[model samples]
Target: MRFSKSLIILALGVSLAACSDSDNNDVEVKPPVVVTPTSYEFTVTITNLTAAQPFSPVALIAHTEGMLWQIGNSASEALERMAEGGDNSQLLTVDFATHAQSAESPLPPGEQLTLTLTTEQLESLKISLATMLVNTNDAFTGLNAIDVSSLAVNESLSRHSHAYDAGTETNSEAHGTIPGPADSGEGFNESRDDINSVAMHPGVVSQDDGLRSSVLTSQHKFDNPVAQIIITRTQ
Candidate 1:
């Protein structure tokens, strides 16, 4: 009887040890987790300060390098398209721009428009915007690649922008060349008929002033600081 009991006890001990070994072998080893970088964002607000001139839908770009237009330099074909005709499709798709956006409609006098853009990083970040003054011939207002890398989230700054002539088209202010409602004429002519370098705009000479053939009147005239731009970092 004693011998039979010893055999039973030894068998039970072996079974328990085998179950313990199996439990140890089945322990789980999880793989490491992966993480992604957060996005940085900015918001831009543009207000037309002109009394009569309306601004075309703005082209807004967030880029690491490159500019929309540079003073004394020849205007790019994309810029000429916007300045001459208020078309911004090409400017938004430039190679150096990482993110771009456009306003939905023309910003009328005294009105404002806001837009937002986002990216993964902020090193060497710049903001550039361009919009045509619909009442003028190839005149535009915007920032040329303003460096905003030092701008902190929730911070803001304002710039009172002056007008610039694309110099691709003459400021003829003729009956059929003005694109605004004053003339409702042609826009974006491909010919580089004027001095082919960008420069500060000379105020428009309307028919009321001296240009007899001018389709524009004194009401369409504007001076420096045609637009007020405010930039804010949101995230």
Candidate 2:
């Protein structure tokens, strides 16, 4: 066709534009990119601050909801087990826990134990721990659902935990009622003979303090701020 040069160029430009549109239509649409949550790790160290009380293996848990024990509430069987007998198996396997860790051995007076936990969840993340004063009847000390979501990587927090009575057993300090070395007595009895509600432990009354039947001597008595806990976000 004998078209003018300007008209020919215009037609060529139009054709190229159409071709580019066709090519663009043939390009496949890509799926959206998925973002994966990051994993975080935390190190928890527990130190016994008591004079003679040794702590049972500690139960460390990371969860979004719920606590191991609450004041004025009845103790769960899991809490009772740990508080009475120093058994942490039940607490470590609670249904609400996303991740959990346990100390390998009992923490003696002036000793400390470190445990670690990792999880991908950071929203509403909470940390809780529970351990028995093995010489007392259902007395435990630990953190309860302490919020840690605000803690950034490498950040740390420290708290001093007080002793709590599981209220599952009486603080008789009797011959066979305590599981610690002071008595070498029984542990984790399926009995609820005490108040059956959690409350601050009224420091123990030992033989020297007029609780004559108490297998615990003056050395076994303990007061508040029984343990010191330090938490660090490692990753």
Candidate 3:
């Protein structure tokens, strides 16, 4: 009986040791996890809300940092080209840009154009747009360096754009200096003859107003919020 009891104790001790070893072996030590890159798609729509003015080809830019134009500062030479001639090559090449697109055709009055851009990262997401008021000299309507990182997927934001002066040329509205279908005159000159600082447009005082030499008419006049912009995230 004594030998049997000793044998039973030994068996119990071995079983307990095996169970402890199995429990220790079964414990899991997971590895650290890694996150991958996430991509996003952005859609921008611009509408010409003017009565008669036809905007030039629209320029859209997605950048990480830096502004295309400022309200109280002098307009960049690139902005001058876009505001004066409806050209956007230089503006697209602005530093820190991630993606860019331009409308193939001008947006006429009450017309809208939609553009899409994609990015992998959301940090420093910025959007800019510009279009010439084809009926005026050195006049443009758009925004510069609008932060869009806060926008969520499938969500959208809207803004009413205000007109701005390039401050590089005088608003003479003369027969030969104004561009667009209204005049088809000179586009851009290196001269800075007007107020060198950018400001809100004083609006076109067309011949119907007080500027008798103005080639523009009442149809060329516009007020604030000349354009409507909507941005949506698809991805």
Candidate 4:
């Protein structure tokens, strides 16, 4: 059949448009665009450097910018609980912290714990860690609100930590005062009989050192550095 000139032109136009659309579809579509949110990750390694003192479960927090605990200031109820009973439940409730974690068990002398924490909060990164010496009245050790925004991937900050007396309780080392395996004594007495401030821990005076009725022993004594902390950014 003979077609009109207008009909022929219209058919040609339609064929060309279909061919153009097919060509466009055949052109490689850049693979579906994918958008991923930025994430920050850190690896924390803690090593117990004491002789016989067992460290409570490490309480770790990755926060925006705030001190969890301060030297010369009274400790929070959370810290006092962990420092006394080796409990970490309360300390993990760091509302200002973007992320926080604790090891399952106590860290013994000469042992280490490595934990990785991640957060989407990429700015003003800081880390705080704490643990109790289960052998003392209220002795604890670890870093507090350390600035880590300057750390590069795979870069690390290492420090040897000194013991800190939480000062929430007196260092009696008596029959019912210590809470470690060495004593199995009671923990977390509400009455505050201590200096009520944080300070450098004085080494323990065991029964061997003339603290009569003391539950600790010579081996439980530790020097300045009680633990080591190494922090690194992985991703």
Q: Which candidate is the best by lDDT?
A: 2
CA lDDT of every candidate: 0.92, 0.94, 0.88, 0.88
lDDT of 3 by residue, 1-235 (tens): 9999999999999998888778886775657686777888999999999987899888888987888888789888998998888888888787767888888989999999999988887887988888999888999998788888999899999999998999989999999888788888888887889987788898999999999999999999999989999999888
lDDT of 4 by residue, 28-142 (tens): 5567878788888999999999999999899899887777678889888888898888887887886777789999899999999998999887678889989999999899998
- Alpha-carbon RMSD, each predicted model: 14.6, 11.2, 12.6, 12.6
Q: Compared with the true structure, what per-residue lDDT tens digits does model 2 show for residues 91-167? A: 99999999999988899999998999999998899999999999998999999999999999999999999999999
Task: Please give, for residues 45-145, the per-residue lDDT of candidate 1 as tens digits.
Answer: 99999988999999999998888988889999999999999999999999899899999999999999899988787889999999999988899999989
Output candidate 2 Cα RMSD: 11.2
Clashing pairs in 3: none
Quote the positional error of residue 219 for candidate 4 in Å.
Answer: 0.4
Model 2 lDDT on a 0 to 1 scale: 0.94
Candidate 1, backbone clash total: 0
Cα miss at 5, model 4 (Å)? 63
Off by over 4 Å in 1: 1-34
The estimated TM-scores of all candidates read 0.85, 0.87, 0.84, 0.84
Question: What is the overall TM-score of model 2 with all chains considered together?
Answer: 0.87
For model 1, give the 10-residue run with minimal summed lDDT: 27-36
Please state the error at residue 133 of candidate 2 in Å. Answer: 0.2
